[model samples]
Target: MPRTPQPRTAVLASADLSFRTRVREALTGLRWEVQEAQGGAEALAYLEARPCEAMIVDTWLPDLEIQEFLAECEKRHPQTDLIAVDDPGPERGPERTQARSPRRNEVLLALRRGQDADHEPQGDGASWNGMPEMTPVHDRTVVREEIFVRGTAVVEATRPGAEPGPGTVRLPELIGEAPAMLEVSRRIRLVAPRAATVLVQGPTGSGKELVARAIHRLSPRANRRLVALNCAAIPDTLLEAELFGHTRGAFTGAVQGRIGRIEAADGGTLFLDEIGEMPLALQAKLLRFLETGEVQRIGDNDPIRVDVRIVAATHRSLAEMVKAGSFRADLYYRLAVFLIRTPGLGERPEDLPLLVERLLARMAEQAPVRRLSAEAMERLRQHAWPGNVRELQHVLERAAILAAESPEIGAAEIEFGETF
Candidate 1:
């Protein structure tokens, strides 16, 4: 019997998730498998752990010096082919990109075609071969930490307007090593860099917004603003103006033309919370903008083009709404290009201990950090957790405050608030 050849594996070392996503989406089905490195260090480590056939190194590596990394690769693994992807020219900001693939005419063609698919008309359109271009992963000059897990690399992006300082805390804490939590992280890795819209579905308080933030933090658009608007919190009367802006004479209260949330979030992400609550009329306008990338201010004839990524979250079932004619089927399909679900607290009880620890840590910044007794923890796990993580945090905060000057919170101190 003839032997089948093993598929070759390749490594992609880059801090830019957008670039990585572009390459992967372009080369959807090739003989070789692809792995990712958060930065040069992770890539080197991955290469050492198991030698691969090739490594695609991005120009702006966050963790290690690009030249030094290239030298190390050349010296350590002389046999592994190296293909460097560089920016086409100077890019202005985090999201601006003009990339050129390896000089070697190999798998890069697939990438070029994939990128062309992004800008070209949907179907029957071939990738533009005339311009040998790659999306530039621009202005990533800062150094940061790298975390490698399983077969993927994770790195924090430097966001504009919300840069973290030495004393600043990023996320309160993820607080889970369980499989469910790990899977959430994995999904973030897969979807963060892609330009596709992401719909995060979960019960209220299951940390859907947190998942959205994680995706933005890991995306190329991190440096740009992440505008979060709660559809349910805002009144239906004002939702239209809030989303699409209004010209000075459009409505009775309109004093001046104002850019709406969609316009404000250009070149970044717009997180729509409780999307199921958005009015059906507004859904039509939103669908128009999604289709044309153009927003028309209320009572304005001109349309404005704004580039924005949509990360929508809702506890309600949109599928049910679609069937019920509450949500437009077309708009639902546009928003759900990619989907991620946040598990409710009860679904992953094993994470309760870590969750308690993180919540207590967050509470410490406000008050003294307290420890949970086993009895208190057991009482927590015993509850149904109908409200999920948000409910848990509220209970813990109340308990911590009620504990007063005590160093330890007893089971009696843990109170279950009004059950959802």
Candidate 2:
């Protein structure tokens, strides 16, 4: 009898999740078992532990110098073939080429397929790629102490506005340097890629939606739709229909048959905002869907299976509500599998300046960017932010309007909103 060949192992090293995903998909039927590494160091360590047939390194590595890393690999792991992906830009390419591998042509073909797929149109006719091209991770960056998990790496931000380095995943929307803020970033990176249900708890206007969006963007479902529903915004009578689909004649409207938010978010992320506001009766049905991954229409007997990640956010305390018999204990446990709390503005006062800069820059699209005078900044520092980041945004908007034609906002332009 003829001998059977074992599948070849390949190591993929890159900080870009989308790139890794595309490459992995391209190699699906190529008899290759691909292992992932977020940086050069991890790749080296992984190769040391287990010999592989080939290793494909990204153009840039987050932890180690690219040229140095390639040299080290050449010297230490001569038995393994090395292939490096081209840089995203046209001006520069991989620093050095490695000796040709037996399967170099096949691997290069797969890399081309992955690269082409990245630039092609995705779902909903949207040209947006899964993730923005991240700034290259340099080897000389300083490591900041872990803000939350022991193993998580957080590179210190070199400037006021800087991109996160290798092994650290920070969304551009999440802007803050406080320990609490960093902890939130750490937790998001940890849970975003998984199928786990995440419960984001925090005070009102503390950027819970931002956290939810971040989770969706970083997850495997990034290319799909991110369906969101504000549980508290809809009336109790219509909320059920909004969540679970209803047949044309299921209810009084009977105008048309339509799917609910859950079904719409199939193979994507379903963001339920203000989840605590959902009525207890409706919570039972939601729990069933979460448990079974099957949702039934209001008047239909057949249930539809869906694959989705749930990211629920709430301003109210579900634990307290459960204690008071207002929320279901079982549902609470299911949703709270991975808890992420967004920090209030008061908790991270040092981030106020950065927040102000970001908000002002956003507002600049409508009008000229206005600078805050020394006294105006002082006044902002003095007031207590009762409404959290939302209130700050409102205050800045008002000040920007009040400043009008002026290039800078003065103390008189600053105004505080009433506490709720």
Candidate 3:
């Protein structure tokens, strides 16, 4: 009797759904079980949850840095065979994915061909572009797919390349083909046409402000002034006066009556940042204004009506704060009429290359063009990025300066620091 073949399990860590799909097609046979992860962080989570014999890291991960992910994968799961699809060419990378498999190259190559074929004008859900189409496959560990409404997209979002489809809204400011970021873009498009309040939630440096700006740009009041105020930045003693305006003699420093940010944004949008830090006392006043559309400047009994749409953002969870009594439940409900979450740098590792490219270009405007060596990029991808995209920009800026003598930033030039 023939001996039974042992079942081998593997993990595919990538933010690209199309890539994930292609891999599924390629590895159809060989009695392999697969686990899927969206980013490096999520990949680690999957690994922690269970062990797989082999793990494949796509050339670009959306969440955690790719180099860092590979390093950490090896360190934590040394027994798990690690495979990385090389940059500049994914076929070879997947070919490396062919490791130890009798028909490894065949499957990986077929996957690559299928991917390249996906780019053609194949009417929706058409054939796998003339490749030796393989049967559909699914992951043993469930995969999370980006939910897109009609006016939306997914991992295959049109970048500089990719066939354009109908109802596709392009947001060049926001880069990253990850599902999380794509969902955000879709939400912005759906809500931009409305005047509803949007509360953006995410960790610090997660581009909450960028999300707000995108919403404002897409709103009906795009031409109107966009007034932004950081509630946490202002002292509690003067937050009220700052928001609602203060009469000339309202306070000692009130040299002259001035309009508040809310009033300043009349007929436009008012962005309230760090709203979770807002005082409980002020929450009542804000709620009243939201209900009545009235703003009363300090020391003035008269209330001025402003037709401003409110868009609030915070790094902390207002829901948790509400339950803890730190935030008003009523106000939280009103402000969060629509919610949008911006993904952190660690969550969108697939965007690292684009971010590195875009950030370097911006730096190039003032300084000489700078490039990052493969190692430098790997260093960046591995980092946890608690500082998020903002930290990414700062790190690149510092690296560019440090590498001033050289045109390319190498791993030695890459530096990491913690910020409170």
Task: State every prediction's TM-score relative to the real structure.
Answer: 0.65, 0.73, 0.61
Give candidate 3 misplaced runs (Cα > 4 Å). Answer: 1-168
User: Across residues 1-420, which tens digit of lDDT does each residue of candidate 2 receive?
Assistant: 998767778888876678888887777568788988765655766787799878888655443345556777887888787876753322365434445467766677778877775556756554332333432323222222212221123443121133433334444567777767867776766566567999999999999988887777556566577889999999999998998889999989868999999999999899999999999999999999999999998888999999989999999999999999999999999999999999889998988898888888879898997888989988888877879999999999999888889999999999895665
lDDT comparison, 1 vs 2, better candidate? 2
Error of 2 at 95 (Å): 18
RMSD (Å) per prediction = 15.4, 9.4, 18.1
Could you say which candidate leads in TM-score?
Answer: 2
- How does model 3 fare in lDDT? 0.72
- What tens-digit string does per-residue lDDT give for candidate 3 at 1-420? 999977677777654567776776666564667776654545665677787777777655432345545766777887676666543444444332322444345445645653574545554643322222211212231111222222122323222223334323435457666667767776775566467899999999887877877676555465577789999999999899889998888889889999889999998889999999999999999999999999999999999988999999999988999889999999999999999898888887988898888778878899988888999989988998889888889899888878877989999888887545
Q: What does candidate 1 score in Cα RMSD to the true structure?
A: 15.4
**Per-residue C-alpha lDDT of model 1 across residues 289-390, encoded as one tens digit per residue:** 899999988899999999999999999999999999999999999999988888889998988887888778868887877998888999999998989888
| Superposition TM-score, candidate 3 onto the true structure | 0.61
In model 1, which regions exceed 4 Å deviation? 1-173
Cα lDDT, model 3, residue 243: 93
Backbone clash total, candidate 2: 0
